[model samples]
Target chain A: MDDLTSDVMFEAFGKTLEEVFEASAEGMFSVICDIDKIKPEESLTIEVSAEDEKTLLYEFLSTLLTESEIKGLFLSRFRMKTERKNNQLIMRGNAFGEKMSPEKGGTVVKGVTYYGFKLEKTENGYRAQVAMDI
Target chain B: MKGKLKKLSEYKWLISKELMKDMRADAIIYANKKLLDEVEEAAVQQLTNVACLPGILEPVLGMPDMHWGYGLPMGAVGAFDKENGVISSGCTGYDINCGVHMLKTDLMEDEVKPKIRELVNCLFANVPCGVGAHSKLRLNSRQLDKVLVTGAGWAVENGFGVKEDLNRLEENGCLKGADPAKISSQAMERGAPQLGTLGAGNHFLEVQIVDQIFDTGAAKVFGITEPGQITVMVHCGSRGLGHQVATDYLKIHESAAKKFGIKLPDPQLVCAPATSKEGMDYLAAMKAAANYAFCNRQIIAHWIRESFSQVFGKKWEEMGMDTIYDVAHNICKLEEHTVRGKKQQVYVHRKGSTRAFPPGHPEVPPLYRDIGQPVLIAGSMGTASYILVGTEKAMSDTFGSSCHGAGRSMSRRASLKKFRGEKIKQELEKAGKALRSTHPKILAEEAPDAYKDIDMVIQSVHGAGISKKVARVIPLGVAKG
Candidate 1:
């Protein structure tokens, strides 16, 4: 993907994730499959509501990663939707995780942690809170 | 949200009952006005929450480096009556016994100045670092068990270090009552290959120079002096082992929290009564992890000695590569202290705080009794690390505990996005410091900018009379994960 296209895709991922949760995204993502080589063949929908954006993002990504690991799926596509009312966040998203082929091993994200978590409003757009497992 | 901070003195602030609900006792935070303003809201709120724990002593104390963390704020010290208190895994953090070890070397900066890059290269090559970093020496299940049970003693017995080194370590390099059997298989597997590795995020091995000495007597006792005398500080923990142990117990303790009818203000502070089976099991496993960390640093220290010997063409003994001290910043210990004018045994939880046992305390090593336990507080790379001693005031006020370091000021993401690692490296190098790392991103995450000012942190504790500063060591070379 070109730099412009990649930037657009990232922006779309951020906006869609925020729309479903009603809060800014404040976590990280891992490409479960080789982004350049894999095709999106299956997807799983996950939704969770949490008291705050921090916990909501943590639970949302953690659920996806846990489910993906157990079912042998490799997440290749990501999008989110959010709604916030009275300081509560309702987050919903579809993370596409294709079944790993025999020739291709899947990438695994251990789990999301509470470090470096943030959710804030911006002038032009929103950014997801990001944290690394390692 | 600003707390109800009543100024007890120029350096002390008290959070009274008016600040929050369910407080069992007042919360005392030591900081000057400037330092207090830099503290995050979450940190103060967490201190209040910690104050609400059952059986807490009269005051939940926050040290100078206090910052936001899982259950208790980092640099918090709380003691509870042994018969009625609770133990929370969050109080110990995921990295059980994460700490700093300082080694004094005869080689001065002037001697190693031309070879600083080569020295760092040697250290980086010898010390495994970064995410999932594994050491060359992988331990079998039985050997790993020995590590958990014996700690640095295991390292000494196996010839990783000399017997003298144990004398300077807290608890003589091993916390008794560690039961390897209590540790889970997952924890064992994670720890097996990570015995001597330096895991990522704030972990480093730095070569420093004793740039200043504030207390002449204390500096002489610590054998640190002058602006050019060289030292090495290793910062790490039990690696995957500690993380897995904490993870395993969190699940167990969460259930225990309900069974014991303990209502924690934060789910992360899941805990059980100190006498409960779950609590005992967690403590056993936690101590085992703590031992693993002690042994991990011992082995790494051995490797550092070897690296110096190889590069300098002299034996470590000849190079004066002697250990000054080893201290654990995350731990809970059962100790007897005066509470309410009577001696009582209490479980003291020091998260991101160091135990600063005063002189004559039997727990202090014999060699340090004349002086006091050497408290190692590591600052960020390019900053100043300090050598301190436990004070009588600390035993009375904080259950013998003090701040660990200049607590983090900004999140890693914020730090990385704001600064470039290459630029940071260049700046340090220009300032006569050497930088070596396997991953540049790791360097960015732990930039000095991410932490509070070390000078202010030291001042607060020194002013509070908890831990007295001995010497200040500044960095000459740094090796990061």
Candidate 2:
């Protein structure tokens, strides 16, 4: 995870696609919540399909941001996996968090931005960068 | 070819189409030499990218406060043809209709100074602040739809404000053609509970005193009779609902761009042809979210009225608390403007800009139409916000627009590293401005040092004859989310 102009950017790497996706989700939540305080008492599942890996990554993080507002929860831990089926990228994911409490630190991120958004394979693994609008 | 900008005037510069390939129009910027030089190449590149977009009616324009943004620069304007141009969700921003409004009060600084701390505390308690701060009223789905349609009118009808407030708001506080059905359930759910919340990051409610009045006649029209008069400034927008609208539509626009065969220089510029089904749908939904923002601010304004009434132990109406004006900086609108001596309707995308209609323009509310639209340029927490009036020059030059705020000279991360929030708070307090916020880091990110000298930005526009300075308001108390 890193930073872009006026937005929070994340870079996640792993040997498998699911590992990078999960890392990306965790990195996003870590920016908005203290993961240590989250008890993982509530579980949420999200499913989405996009044209490619980059769009898939954007939608995945966007869903999490929307869920935070809709469910009134500050999510922390996340588990996800992506698969390519019939030339489309499909993602099924689960997120964990609890109700938003004032004791929680960190600011709210408005949305994910396409500014400097990219997904690529590293020398050792797959990597993705997502910049969130804070 | 990439960074060359030909000086056009003292405060204007042009990047010819020769600077970038596929550019349909020249890129123009309203900036002084220092500001022009300070603009990064990447942000300028975004302007050139905007120039290359299809169906642009005039030169791509950037205000003095211009900086890098997702697709278009933050302080950029791109007015496109209604039939042939495109509509972009990215251009409108994440928090739709994120804007600032000012309310005037008869009380002066001397009257409020002794009770400044109490007043600040009352405002903080009355108005919801911080992330996930829920509104006192949890509206159902049906009421949410009414907000998406009636805008501030809904708030007034619900006893939040008076009918006269609708007259002072841009678009009468509601945008026509806003189809609530176009809004997704996700956007609805997020909006329902979040109404009236002062969301985090740069959103604030400030108690100010009329520090200086530049144009006495203009200031008088804006309800500023004398210096030291108390005023309240509310800065916020359509919290989660507007964000979700932009987020949901961005994906649709991305696919629509491909479907329309529009090759964008940046993915963030993804857009649909303005007349296409996708474009129409996005516009409808965007308007709905924009209305939500209007109501959101209206509700806050009502609460602010209550807080003032409580602190003074008098009715707000008896205290002469009246809405001066409300304007949205983020969002696009269909407006009639004269371009190259021809009258036409164009969709003006003002990302980090405000509508500054010249005097006598029909769109200008009747009350101030003879004077011009009141342009509110909010400064950083530590500086003075200027009230400017629109000029005819702006109508022909920049689609009747002006800079929105003290545009950030540095990014949030950079500011965080350069200044501590606690130190900034202390500095503000020492300077007689009481600062309160949910998180200290927010104070650091919004430090005045992180932004450009707002006076210089105002000078550029005023000197360029785009807008005229009316008055300056200085902060006495600030509450942030």
Ten residues in a row with the worst lDDT in model 2 chain B? B1-10
lDDT of 2 by residue, B221-251 (tens): 7779899999899988898899888888888
Per residue, candidate 1 scores C-alpha lDDT tens digits across B1-481 of: 3556889998899999666768888988988888898777778888888778888887898888888776777789878889899888867767789899889987888898888888888988898765434578868899999989999999999999999999989988899999999987767876787788876567789999888888887777667666688999999887767877876787688889999899887776778899999989999999999999999999999999998887888999998888999999989889999987899999998988999989888988887887778889999877999989999998898899899998887765566678888888999999888898764655676788888899899999989898898888899889876
DockQ of 1: 0.07
C-alpha RMSD by candidate, in order: 7.1, 1.7
TM-score, each model?
0.84, 0.97
Candidate 2 per-residue lDDT, tens place, A47-124, comes to 878898877887888887888778888787777777778988999978888887544646778888877677898888
Query: Evaluated with DockQ, which candidate comes out highest?
Result: 2
Cα lDDT tens digits for candidate 1, A1-134: 11110010112123444653322221223223344454568877778888976567657766665455444455656667678878678777776646643223311223344444454556545455544333
Model 1, clash count?
17
Clashing pairs in 2: none
